[model samples]
Target: MEKETDSSEMFIDPVCLMKVDSGNKNLMFTHQTRTYYFCAESCRKRFAGNPDKYLSNKSPKRKGLWGRYLDRLNKTTGGKSLNCH
Candidate 1:
């Protein structure tokens, strides 16, 4: 287990960050003591099915303008916004 402060610094799935229950352990992970939030049980399942795949995809190389935009939206929405855009 990781400290809450350390977990707070981890990356969160853009889709999950908007949900009140997004940080559930069943739908999250801790890598290097950093917590990661997932969008849903399915997303968590997918990640668990192949952690390497998702973990590898987590690198900066996989991020794009859309991701940044979504992150900005997440912050502005107060984590309550929802859009498949």
Candidate 2:
């Protein structure tokens, strides 16, 4: 039997960086002692195609509305701060 992995902890999908409940082992895959969860099959497939890309620590910043607004302000300053001025 597959050793039951801890399901209570939540983790972000390496592919999308979206939070996921790790307890749902049915929706997860393991690689190099790390667990990855997927909110969709497409995301899972994308991760499988090139796990290294998604697993990298240098993940692209998420393009949420707030992030975009902050990025615009930081574009000239080269900072990630939230200060608009």
lDDT tens readout by residue for model 1, 1-85:
7655443444456433334343366777665675567767776666666666655654777676589898898899988868769
What does the lDDT come to for candidate 2? 0.75
The ten-residue window of minimal lDDT in model 1 covers 14-23
TM-score of each: 0.41, 0.59
> Residue 44 in candidate 2 has what lDDT?
80
The CA lDDT at 66 in model 2 is 69
- Where does candidate 2 stray beyond 4 Å? 1-6, 57-71, 75-85
- Please give the lDDT score at residue 74 for candidate 1: 87
- What residue pairs are clashing in model 2? 7-23
Query: Global CA lDDT of candidate 1, please?
Result: 0.63
What lDDT does candidate 1 reach at residue 76?
94
